[model samples]
Target: MTLDFSVVTGAWQSLLLGTVGTLFLAFSGMALAMIIGVLGVVILRMQLRLPSLLVNAFIEIVRNTPFLVQIFFLFFALPLAGIRLNPTLTAILALGVNGGAYAIEIIRGGVESVPKGQTEAGLALGLHKHEVFRLIVLKPALRAIYPSLSSQFILLTLTTAICTSISAYELTSVGQRIEAETFRSFEVYFTLTGIYLVISLVTMWLLAAIGRRAFSYPQR
Candidate 1:
């Protein structure tokens, strides 16, 4: 038997909107994760036991728990505590918090990769500790770990589909609605699978380009 993809043309608009929503969710999440990762690394590098323990706890909690549950907690459970977040904001927070936990570890590895000599040199050269870490260590470390960070970001993008479970109205949700209206389950999901693939490919490409530009250095 042949497939009937005639429904796609009709569902096109919704799919496009859903795609935008998905991209917004993924990008916002990754950006917030980057902030958290950078700050977390700095805190960890300070070697302050209490702060490090707290950061570690945050990472372990997010990493060990289910992401879907995290999103639900933000969207549904928070209201019980007299704090309410809109679906989009909750989705971003969930994705960001989850991705950030992993990002912290990955970035900490990067920071540790820097030679101890460099840190010593910066300190001897009259730089403040924070300045030394930021200028002499963090940048090069980030460059070294760019590939791992990019991969993590891609994984974070794929996780955007989970946002649909909380009614964040991303691509997966759109596909589900389309399937209900058109009664074409296979077609809906098959198309969504392809769409996700394309989305990931484009995201990877963009990340690569940004990495090259942001991390590139002049030849010695």
Candidate 2:
């Protein structure tokens, strides 16, 4: 049987909308993950007993558990506890929280790679500890770990498809709707596979450009 591209063409509008939603979710989730990563690293640096333990526990739980289980808990369990979240919000939150766990370790490793001498010098200049961390340590550390962090963020974007499990209505969800309506499973899903591949490829290209601009430095 010959493959028909028209089916995909017909549903392209919905698919495009879904793709936009996926991008939005991915960006928002990554932003939140970065925030969590930075804050988690700070908490670890503080060396406080209780807060450090809490952050570590959070990291362990998120990194060790299945992503689907985490999404399920946030989407379903929270509602029972008098905390209701819209599906898209739930998707973003779940992805952010899960990605943040891995991001913490990645960012922390980056921070650790920074020379202690540099941090000391920053402090010796009468800068506050936070200022030293921000200006002297964090930027260089992020540059070192940019590749790993970008890869993690891409993985988070791909995981957006799993949001369909909770009816969050992203790309996969839109494709499913098209398939159900058209009764053309092969055509619909094949198109979806291609779209996801394109999204991933384009995301990587954009990230590489951003890294070059933000992290690359000229030699003196």
Candidate 3:
């Protein structure tokens, strides 16, 4: 059968709307994840043993489970237990929690990569532990993990398609809707794949640029 561009062309507005939703969900989720990750990393690195154990348990649970199951539990099961989140909120929260676990590992690795000598040097200079971590460690650690972090964000963006499973009307959902309405499965899905690919590539480039600008001093 000859390929039809008509179905794709016809769904332009719907696709654009879906793209906006996808971007919103992905970036918002990443932002929330970043906040949780920073706090979790600090907690995990605490001198106290209990804090480390609690943080590790949180990371282990989130990293071990499938994100889809997590989303289902948050969206479906929570409501049954009286915590009713709307679809978009559920998607954001699920993605944030899942991504935050992964970010914790990345951020922790970055933290550990900083030289022991640097911490000692900072201490000798009379810098407090928190001051040393904030000024000497965190920025360099972020620089060390910059590539990994950017890649993770990109992956998170693509994973936002899973929101469609919970009926969040993201890009994938738009494609599904178009296919249902037009009965042009191949055309609709092919267009979707290309659209998502373009979106992901662009996001990667944007993140790379941001990392370059933000982490420039670390290279010196």
Candidate 4:
């Protein structure tokens, strides 16, 4: 059978829009995940029995469940509780919540890897506990875990494709529409694969740049 990619040409604008939508969801979700990760680590470190247990429970639930189910619940079930969210909002919230679960563990491991002496030293310098964590421990810990965090974010980006299952606007959803209109499943999917590869590569490059700017310190 002869292959024709002509169908994609007609839908280029839609595909571009979808790419933008995917990027918006991924980046917004990532921001929320980072916030959750940092806050969750801080709460866990506080050693408050109840808060720690709650945070741990949240992490366990998110990590153990499939993301598709999580998104479905947010999109379908939350409305029953009188909490309605548009598809876009639900997708972002789901991605953030799911990514945050893993982020909590990844960040906690990095925090634990820091030498206790550093925390003590910061305390000795009259730094508040919050100051000590923010100024002394957090930066180095994040630098050490940058690679792992970067990988997780990349995975999170690809996971946006699954958001389409909830009728959320994203690259995969656009591809589905194009495929329906053109009846060219192979061509549509092949194009999507290429687009996704480009997005992933670009994301990796951007993350590498951010890491260098944020974590690089001059060696003495």
Highest-scoring model, TM-score: 4
Better-scoring candidate (TM-score), 2 or 3: 2
Measured with C-alpha atoms, the lDDT of residue 80 in candidate 4 is: 94
Model 3 C-alpha lDDT per residue in residues 176-205, reported as the tens digit of each score: 988888888999988889998999889888
Going through the candidates in the order shown, the clash numbers are 0, 0, 0, 0
lDDT of 2 by residue, 1-220 (tens): 7777788898778999999999988999999999999999999999999999999999999988999999999998988999999999999999899989999999999999999999999989999999999999999999999999989988998999999999997899999888888788899989889998999999899999999999889869
- Candidate 1 lDDT tens digits, 72-153: 8788788999988888899999989998999999999988899999999999999999899889998999999999989988
The lDDT per prediction is 0.90, 0.93, 0.91, 0.94
- Candidate 3: misplaced stretches above 4 Å? 218-220
TM-scores of all predicted structures? 0.95, 0.97, 0.93, 0.97
Rank list by lDDT: 4, 2, 3, 1
Clashing pairs in 2: none
Off by over 4 Å in 4: none
In angstroms, give how far residue 145 of model 3 lies from its true place: 0.1
Clashing pairs in 1: none
What is the alpha-carbon lDDT of model 2 when measured against the actual structure?
A: 0.93
Choose the strongest candidate by lDDT: 4
Model 3 RMSD in angstroms: 1.7
Candidate 1 RMSD to the correct structure: 1.4
